[model samples]
Target: MKTFCNQEHQDQAVEAIKSLVAIPSVCNEDANDGTPFGADIQHALEHSLELCKQLGLETYIDPEGYYGYADYGEGEEMVGVIGHVDVVPAGDLRLWNSGPFEPVVKDGKLYGRGSQDDKGPTIAALYALKAVIDSGAVFNRKIRFIFATDEETLWRGMAQYTKKERIPELGFVPDSEFPLVFGEKGLLQLHINGTGSNTLNLSCGDAFNVVPGGAVYEGSRASELKSALDELKFEAKIDGQKVEVSGKSVHASLADQGINAIVRLAMGLLKIGEDHPMLHFLAEAVGLDGYGKNIFNGVLEDDVSGKMTVNAGMLNIDTNSSQLSVDIRIPVKISKDDVVAQITTVAKEYGLTYEEFDYVASSYVSLDAEPSITLLNVYQDLTGDTKNKPITSGGATLARTMPNFVAFGMVFPGESKTEHQANEFMVIKDMAKAMEIYAHAIYRLCCNQK
Candidate 1:
C-alpha cells in the first residue's frame, strides 16, 4: 500500500477551513415566520456545495433545508462525514479581540465563531476527503460528506436530512473530542418562567445556551433606580417617558458586547432580594437550589463535563406577564424523567411555574467501535500522544442527530472555547493536521477493506 503524505495536501486543507469560516452563519434564532431555524443555514449549505463542486466531489442538499453533503464514490456501505455550519451567535464582540467571521489568523490560532465549534472542523474534513481523492486511492464504499445547520439548536438538520438519505455503515463527525468519544450525555434545555418581579421593571440576557453576560432590574422608584443603574452603566435601555418604564431589547447572545439603553436604565437599584420568580425557576432547572446559590450552592457538579452549566439567558416582564429564560447544560447520563421531575418539583416549591420549550439529547461515539478506533489510530499515527481519550461534553454537534455519528477534533489542547464566546478561531497548521487525520481515516474506511 502506498501512503500519501505531503505539503500540497496540507495547503489545500488550510484553504478549505478558511473559506468555510468566512461565512457568518450564526444559528441562534430561527428564520422569521418559521423559515427554518437560523436564516443563514441555506447560505452555508450553498457555500458547502460550492466547495464540493469545486473539489469535484458529487454533492446534493437533499429535500430537507437543514443540511447537504458531498460524495466520493458508489458502494454498499456509505461513510458520512458530518459537520454543522450553523454557529451560535458570537456573544459580545467586545470580548472578542477580532471580528467573529473575519477569519483572523494570529500566533498559530484562527479566531471566529464556529471556528472551533464545527465549521473549521467541517472544512477540515472536506479537505481531508480532497486529499484522499487527490491521493489516487480507490474505495469500495461511498463517502457521504454532510454538514448540518441545526446541530446546536437540536439535531433537526441531520435528523431530517438522514430521513431521506441513506445512513452510513460507519462514520464519524469532526465536531467533538478526538481519540474516540465512547459515551455522550444527553442534552437538555429548560425555560423557567413567571419570575419576572413586577417590582423590577427590566431584565434580559445574552442567549438561551450561554451564561448571561449581564443582567438588570429596576423598581417603581424610577428616579432612584435610574440613578443607581446609570452609576453602574449596565447594558440595555429603560426609559420613563409616560409615567411607565419602556425597555429596549438588545441581541440576547451578545450581552457582554455592551449594555443596551433599557437595561442600563433599569439595573443598579434593584438587589437580588427583589423576589425574582424567574431567577428562582432557572436555578431549579439544572438541579440547582431554586432559592439562589445561598440555599444550595447553585451549581450542578458532573464528573464528565466538569460542572453543571447554567446561563441566565433571558428575562422579560410586562404588565400582563413575567418570565425568566435560562440555559442549562448537564451531563447526558441524567435521566430525562428525573430532570423533569426535579425541575417541576422545584417550581412547585417556589410557587412559580416552568416549562422546557427546547432540548437536544447528548451524543456518544463509542471508542470500542471500529469507526472510533480507526479515526483515533489515524490521529495517533500523527501526534503519538495517547492520553487524550474521547470524553463526553455538554457541547454537542451534528452527530447527536444521527444514530452512528460522533464529533471528532477540530480543536486540540491549550485552546480556549470561542464557540458561543468571542474571538473564536482555529490555527491553519492545526487544522491541516486534522485534515491529514481525516484523510487517513476516510481512506481506510472507504477502501475495499471491510
Candidate 2:
C-alpha cells in the first residue's frame, strides 16, 4: 500500500510513451528474416528492448520477430508482465485532431493512436519494474516483461513466444481496466463466402475487430437504395452510379455501441432486390442487430460473463465472388464449437460458405486466487476506491494464452474506452497512478517476504 512511485517516475513513463508513439508500428504483411511483422513493428520491438537494457535489465529479442522480453532479479520462480507494441491501422487520419503517430499533450492528456491501447501502459510497466529494482528489494522470483508485435492482428507473436520461451506461473497483462479483470469472453473471427452478382461492387471496413464506419457501393437501383437509407435516417451519398454510407465505428467486442455501415448498406441494397444473394445474406444473417439473434438462433448470454456480440466488420462484393468478415465475442459459458456449428448451418442455408479462425478461448481466475486478491487490494489501496468489483470483458487479451494469467489495469474506471478508435488518448494522471499500482503489485509478487 506504500507509495513507491514519484514525479520522476511519472515523467520518465511519459517520455517513454512519447518516444514509442512517435513510431507508427502498425502491423504489415511484409515479412523478412528479422521483421516478420514488417520493419516498423520490428523497430518498435528493438526500441523497447533497448530501453529495458538501458534500465540495466537483461533483454532478449526473438530472432524471428515473434516477441521480446526483459528480465530483472534472479530466482527459481518468475512473474510476468505482458504487453503489445503493435497498433491497429489509424483509419482515415482526417478523423484525428493530431497525427496518429505524433504524440501530443493537451489538457493533461496524451493523444495518439497507441497511447491508451498499449504504448502508454507498456512504458508504465517497464518503469514499474525499474522502480522495484531501484528500491533495492530482495526478490525470490524473477520478473519478465514481455513485448509482443501481433496482438492487433492474429496474436501470432505471443503464440510463437509461448512455444519457444518460458511461461510464467503467475502473471498479469496491463492491457485492460482496473480494479481487475477476472473473466474474458472467447474471441472468434469468421469468414462467410458467397457468389457475387453483377449488380454491385462494394468494399468496407479495415479490420475484423472493428465495426465498419463507411462503405462504398457502385451499382444499379440507386434511387431505391437512397430511399431506404433516408427512411432509416442513416448518412449516405448518392452520385450517379456510386453510393456511400457512413456509420459509427467501435470495437467489435462492443458491437452494440456501433452502427455498422456494412450492414446498413446491405439493408438498403436489399430494398432494391430481395433475391440478391450477398445483400440478402447480410440482411438476414448479419442484420442491423448486434446480437446475431435472427442469424444464429438467439443471443447467447450467461450469468458469469454476459451476452454474446456479433459484428460484420468487413465486407467485399463484386461480379465474381463476395466475402463477409465477421467478429464475434462469446460469453465464458458458451462453447465456440456450438456457435460455429449454428453459424455454419445458417450460412449454408443462405448459400454462403462459413469458416471460423483465430479462436481464443475465454479465461477466468477465481476471486479467491491470491494473485487476483493481491491485485485488487493494490488497486483499492492506491486509489481509495473499493466499490468497483472485478468484472468480465468482451475483449480478449494475452492473459488468455497462459495459465494463471489475467489482465490487470492500465485503463482506469470511468475513463473513456477508446482502444482502436480515432483520436485515442490517455489521461496523464491515470498513467502515473497505474505506474504506482503496477510497481507495488510487481514488488509484492517478486520480492521475498520471508
Candidate 3:
C-alpha cells in the first residue's frame, strides 16, 4: 500500500480527477444510441474507461452506454467498487471563484463541480486498485470498479448494469464519508399535479434533487408578492406583472441548509390570496419545514435513519395546470407504500393528483457484518479517528443498488460538504490520503490471506 502511495501515483490521481471534472459530465434528459445520458456523459465514461485500459486493467463499456466497468484480477467471487462519473449541474456560476468545469487547485483545494461528490473519489479508488496490482498482491477474488453515468439523475445506468452483469458478493461505494455509512434512507420522488389560475406562468428548479435557488412568477398579484418578498427580506424584483425571487441553492438531501426560492415565492403568493391552488399547494402541502409534518401527519421516523426529509425541488404553474416535484428521503423503517398513500390522500384534498415517478428502497448493512467491520477497521486504523462510529445518511449512493454494499469515504469527518453546491471542491491532500486509505481497504478486502 505504501508503494502505491508514492508521490507519483498521488500526482496521477490528482491529474485524473481534474481531467474528468473538465468534461462536465452532467446527465441530460435526451437519449440516443450509445448515449442514454447525452453525448457528453458518454464521452466522460469513454475517457475514464480508456484511462483504466492505460493502467493495464481489463475494461468494458456497455454497448448502449448505460454503464462501464474496469476489472482487475480473475476469479469467480468478485468485490465491487461502484462509483459514478456524472455530476449535478453547476448552479449559479456567478457564485464560483473558478469555472465549474475548469478544474483548478488553489489554497490546496481542487475546485470543480464533481471534485468531492464522486469524480475525485472514483479516481482515488482507481489508483488504489492500481496500487494493489503494482504491489503484486494475491487476490482471493476479482475486483471490479463499476462506473455509472446516471447516478446524479435516475440511476438508470446502474439499473441496466445489474440486469446484464454479475452482482458482487460484497463491496463498498467510495462516494460518501470516511467513517463509513451503514444505512441510507429510501428515496421517493412524487409529482403533485393540479389545475391552477391567478398565476399565468411560473417556473423554478432544473432537477428534482436540488433546492431551487431562484424562481419567476407572472400573475395578477405581482405587486403584492413583491411587497411580501421585501417584508420577508428575500432578494426579489417586480417587473411588469412578474416577480423574481432569489435564494441559496443546496442539495435536496440537505434541504434544511438552503432557502428554496420556489417555496418562498409560493409563500409570498399565499399572502396575496390563500385560495390560489398553486399558492395553497405550496403553503399547506409542502410547508416550510423540510420534514413532511404538515402534509402527512409526520408519521415517518425511525431509530436507524432518523426523521424523513421532504424537498419541494421543482415547481411549475400555468393557466391550465400546475405540477410540483417533491423529493422525499424516508426513514429506513417506514414503508414506501404507506408514505405514498398518506401523501396521496393529502394531495387529493388539495385538488392535486399524486404520482410517484421514482423510488429506491432503503439500505442497511449491519455494523457487525464482515464488510462493515472490515472497512470500519481500515478507516479507524489509518486515520486514528475512532470517535466517529458508523452512521446513517439521508443521501442515496450506488451502495444501495447491490446486495452487501455500503458507502465508504472520500469525505472526511467534520469536512465541509460541497456536493451539489456551487464551487464544489475537494482538498488535494485529503484526496491523496483517500487514495492510500482506499488502496489499503482494497488490499485487505480483496488480497489478504484468510
Candidate 4:
C-alpha cells in the first residue's frame, strides 16, 4: 500500500479528536432527553456521523440513539472497524493541569478526556479509511465502521446494534494498544448487595471500569476516623464530619497499580470501630488484594492471561441496604460460572449476595488465524519490529462482543497509559503513526485481499 496518509490527514485527525473531546460525552442516565446515553452523547454521535459522511461514506445512526455506523465499498464479506465514543467520568478535577473536557495541545500531546482511551484512536481509524478511499484503492470487500456509544458502561448500545443489525464476519477494535491484541480476559461486573449500618452512611466511586481515586466518608466520628487514617498512613483530608481519602486512579484493568480510595476508606473506617457489613467486606474480604486471594482462598491465575484481578469500583452504604460494585478480570482458562460460584459462596459469609450485572466472555484469536496473521504482517512491514508479539490483555474491548475479532493499534509499546484517568492524553505523533497503520491494515484486509 502506498503512503496515502499525509500531514493533511494528521491535522484533520487531531481537529476531529478535539471537536469530539470538547463535548463531555460521559453517560447521563438522567437527561430525560429520550436519548439512551444522554444529550451530549447524542451530539457526539451526530458529529461522528457527519465526519464519516464528509468522507463520502454512507452513515446511519440508530433512531433511538443507541449506536451508529458508516459503510464504504460493496461486497458480501465486510471488514469491521469498531470503536466507542463515550468516555469515563473525569474524577477529581483538581488533579488535572487543565480542564478535563477542554481540549488542548502541549508538549506534542493532546490532552482531553477521550483523547487516548478511544476517541483519538477511533478518529484515527476513520481517517485511515479516508486515506484508502482517497487513494482510489480497489476493494474486494465492504468496510464498516461501528461507533459504539456505551462501551465504558454496560455496552447496552452495542447490544442493541447487534440485535438489530448484521454482524460483520470479522473486525478489529482500535480501542487498545499496538502491536495488536489477540486475546482478552473475561470481564465481569458484579454488584454485591448486603445490609448496612444505621450509623455509617457512605457512598463514592465513578464507574466499574475505573479505579476510584477519591472516596469521602461523612459520619458522627470525624476526629476518630482521621486519626485512624493517619495511623494507617493513608493520604486523606478531614474537615469536621467529612473525611476524604486520596488514591492514584488508573484503568480497572490495571487495578494492581492503582490505590483504590474506596478500599482505603473502608480500611480506615474499620480501624476506627465503624461496624458495617459493606465496610468489613471491603476492609477484610477485599483490602488491597487485586487477585482476591483472601476472598477466594487462593490466587486465581493462568498462563494465558496472567492473573485474575479485581477492583472495588463503587460503594454505597445506608441504613437499610448496601451495594458494592466490583469489576473482575477472570483469566482466560477460568470458567465464568466457576468464578461466580466462588464469589457467591464468599459473599454470603459477609451477608452479601454476588450478582453479576455485566459480563464479556474471554476472547482468544490465534496468531495463525487469518486476520491475525494478515494484520501482523502489515505491522511488521510498516514498523519492522517483531519483538512484541501478539499478547493478551486484562481489559475488555468491543472486539469480544462477537467472534472473529481482535483489538489493534493506537497505544504503542513503552507508552504511558492515561485512559480513565485525569488529564488523559494521546501523543500526536504516535496517533498519526497509528492512522498510517490502520490505513495499510485496512487496505490489506479489504482492498488488497487475494
Candidate 5:
C-alpha cells in the first residue's frame, strides 16, 4: 500500500473523468453509424483509447467499435482491468442541477451522469495504473485495460471481446463497492407483453437497469388520475390532460431504495378504475415490494446473496399492445430458470407473455482465492478496516466476463449511493483513495513476481 498516487495524479484523474463525463455516450441502437452501440459510445471508446495511448500503453480499438483495450508488460499470464465506457441514459434532464453530460465540480464532488457508476472509476483505474507505471514497477505479467462498449445494456460488446481476444487469467473490475466483492447476484432483464387497453396509452422508464424516476399519463383521465394521486398522497404534476408522478431513482439492483414513479402511476390509474394489463400487473403483482415476495411467495431468498429483488423498470401500454420491462437480481444460489418460471407463471395469469431480454449469470470468487485475498489485503492495509470484509452485491459487473475475476473498489462503505440517480456524483477525495487502492491491488496482482 505504499503511496505512488499524489496530488498531481489525483488532479489528472479528475480531469480525465470530467472529459469522459462530457460525452453523452448513452447507447443508441438505431444510429446509422456502423458502430455497434452508436456514434457517441464509439466516440467514448476512441477517447479512452487515446488516453491509454497517451499514458504509454499499446492501445487497440476494435475495428467494429465493439470494444477496446490497452496493454502493457508481457507474459504468458495476462491480468485484466475491465471497465465500460457506455452509461445508462440520463433520464429526465430537468431533474439535474446541471446537464447530465456537463461535468461540474462543486463542494468536492464531480457531478454528471456516469461520474460514479463507471467512467470516473475507470479513469481512476487508468491513472492508478499510470502511477504504478510511472514508478517503474516491475511487471511479472501483462496487464490489459479493457474498455467495453455496452455495459449499461446487454454485455454484447464484452461478448465480442471475449469471442476474439485472449482471456485474462485473473482480474478485478473497478465497478463496485470496497473492500472487495466476493460474489455477485445473477442479473435478469425481461419483458412481459400482454393485451392493451383501447383507451390507455402510456410509457415510462428508459432502461431496464434503472428505476424510473417519473411516469406520465396523457389521456382524458388526467383529472381523475390527479385526484386519485392526491388522495393517495403521491407526488405528481398535472397540466391539462397530462399527469406526471414523481419518485426516487436508484439502480434497479437496489430497487428497494427507490420509489418507482411507474408503480405510483399504476396505483393512481387503478384507483381511478382504469384497467389495462400492464397497469394491473404493476399495481397487483409488483407494487412497491422490491423483493417481489407476492409474486413468488417469498421463495427467492438465499443466505449467501440475501433476498431476490425485482424492479418493474419500464411500463408501456398502447391501443393494441402492452409491455412491462422487469429487472430481477437473483441470489447467487438461486436458479435463473426457477425465477423465470415463477415470473412466467404469474405473467400467464395476467395473460402476459414473458420474454427474456438479457441475463448475466452470478459470479463468485472465494475470499481465500488469489486475487480476492490479495485485493482485500491491499484494501485493509491501506484503509485499516478489517471489520469490512468481502461481501456479495446485487449489481452486475464486468467481473462476470472473465474467469477468476471479481469486482473491487470505487465506492467506499457508508457513502451515499448515487450511481444511476439524478445529480449522480463521485466525491473527489474518494476518487483519489480508490486510485491508491487500485494501484496497490494491481501491483500486488501484476507486479513484483519472479
Candidate 6:
C-alpha cells in the first residue's frame, strides 16, 4: 500500500463526513412508512452508496431500505465496519450552543447534530476503506461497511439487516468512546401506565429513547400551574397556547436533560428543599447542583461518556392524578436495582406513584477485548496517540444490540460528548484519525486474517 496518510485521502474523509452530516438523518423513518428511518436515513444511505460505488464496491440496498455491501476480496472471511447514519433528534434547538442542523466550525471543532455520533465515524470508516483500496492494499478477506438507519429509536435497521444477511466474522461500531471499549452493559426499557388520573395528568418529551425535556401537570388551571413555575429555573413556554417549560442546554429524551427542568420546577414548588425526593432524584442522577446534594451525591462524575444522567421526561395528569416518568443513563457501577429502589422508596414516602422506563442501557465497550484491542491499537499506531488510554461511557449507542459489538471511535479523545446533546460536533482532524484507525483495523481483521 502506498501509505494512506496522503492529503487526498484525508480530504475525501472530511468531505464524506460533511456530506453525511448535512442530512437530518433523525428518525424520520416511521415503520409504517416503510421508510423505517425517514428521508434522512435515505439520504445518509444514499451518501454511503455513492461512496461505495465510487470505491468500486458492489452494494445492495436490502428490501428493507437498509444499504449494505459485499466488497469482495476473494476470501470467505469477511470483516465489517458497522455504523449508523441516523441520529437522535436535534432537540431543544434553542438549547443548542449552535444550530442542530447548521454544521459549523469553532475553536477547532465541527458542530451539528450528527457530527460526533455515528455519521462522523461512519464516514471516516468509509474513507478508510477508500484510502486502503486506493493505496493498492491487497487482502484476501471481504470488508463490508454497513450503513444503517433507525438506530436512534430502535435498531430495526441493523437488526433487520443482520437477520437477512450474514455479517462479517468480526467488526466495530465507530460510534462510542475511543482507546476501545471492551465491555458493554445490557439494557432494558419499561413503559408504566396509570389506570387514570385527572389532576395527576402530565406528559413531556418527544422520543422514548431520550430523556424527556419537561412535563406538565394540569388541573382546571394549567395557566396558574404554569404561573407558579414561571420563576423557576425552566423558562416556561406555551405551545398552541398550552403551557410548556423550556430550559437552556437541555434535551427531552435523555434523562439528564429532563432532570434539568424537573429539579428547577421542584425547587420552587416543593419548598421541601433539595433533599426532597423529586428534587434529589433529578439532581443526583443528572449531575447538577441538584437539590443541593452535589457534595454528598457525587454528582460531578459522568465519566467516559461525560456524566451519568437522568431526566424527569414525561408526565400525564388529569383532574384526578398525575403520571410522572423519567429517562435515566448511569454508569455500570450504578445499580439499576438502586434506581428501582430509590424511585420506589421516594414515591412511597412522597405519596406518589413512580414507574421505570428503559429506552437504552448505559453502555461501555471493553478496553481489553479482541475487537477493542484491534480497534485501539489501530488508532494508536496510526495516530501516534499513545498517551490516551481506553475509556468508559454512559451514552447508549447501536452496540446495545449485537452481544459482542463495542463502541469504537467516532468521537476522538479529548472531544465533547455530543451524541444526544445540542450542537453536536466532530473535528476534521478527528475524522481523519478515525479513518486511519478503521483502515488499520480492517486490514488486521480481514486482510491479515486475525
Candidate models: Cα lDDT each: 0.62, 0.87, 0.86, 0.90, 0.91, 0.61
The lDDT, on a scale of 0 to 1, for candidate 3 is 0.86
lDDT winner among the candidates?
Answer: 5
Task: List, residue by residue over 1-450, the lDDT tens digit for candidate 2.
Answer: 467788888898898999999999988876554578898999999999999999999999998888999998878888999999999889877679999999999999999989988988989989988888888888788989999999988999998999999999899999999989989999999899999867667778899999887787776677678888899788998999778888888889889888889989988877766466767777877787788898767788999999999999888887898999999999999988899999888888888888776788899999899689888888898789988889999988999888888899888888888888888999998898899999999988999445
Name every residue pair that clashes in candidate 3: 177-409
TM-score of 2: 0.96
lDDT of 1 by residue, 1-450 (tens): 345546776666566667777777766453574446645667777888888899898888755466788888867878888877887776556567878777777898877777777877887777777777887788889888877777666667766776777788777778766665655555556665563344555545555655444444444555555445455543334556212222322222222332233222223333323445544444333222221233234544466544444444566776556765654455655566766676666667767676886776666666677677777777788779688776776554556666766667767755444566556667777777677777788888887475
Q: Please say which candidate is ahead in lDDT: 1 or 5.
A: 5
- Kindly report which residue stretches of model 2 are placed more than 4 angstroms away from their true locations once superposed: 31-34, 219-224, 238-242
TM-score of each: 0.81, 0.96, 0.95, 0.98, 0.98, 0.77
Error of 3 at 26 (Å): 1.6
Cα lDDT tens digits for candidate 3, 1-450: 154577788888899989999998898766554478888889899999999999998999999889999988766788999989999888777778999999999999999999998999999899888877888888888899999999988899999999999999999999999799999999999899998665357777878888888888876778888998898787998898888889777778777777888888888877766466656878777776778688877646898988888899888777778899999998899898888888888888877889888999999999998689889988888889999888999899999999899999989999988888888999988888888888888888888746
Give the worst 10-residue stretch by lDDT in candidate 4. 285-294
Give the C-alpha lDDT of model 1.
0.62
Model 1: lDDT of residue 294: 31
Native RMSD of candidate 5 (Å): 1.0
Q: How big is the positional error of residue 434 in model 3, measured in Å on the Cα after superposition?
A: 1.2
Pitting candidate 1 against candidate 6, the one with the higher TM-score is 1
The full ranking of all candidates by TM-score, starting with the best, is 5, 4, 2, 3, 1, 6
Give the C-alpha lDDT of model 2: 0.87
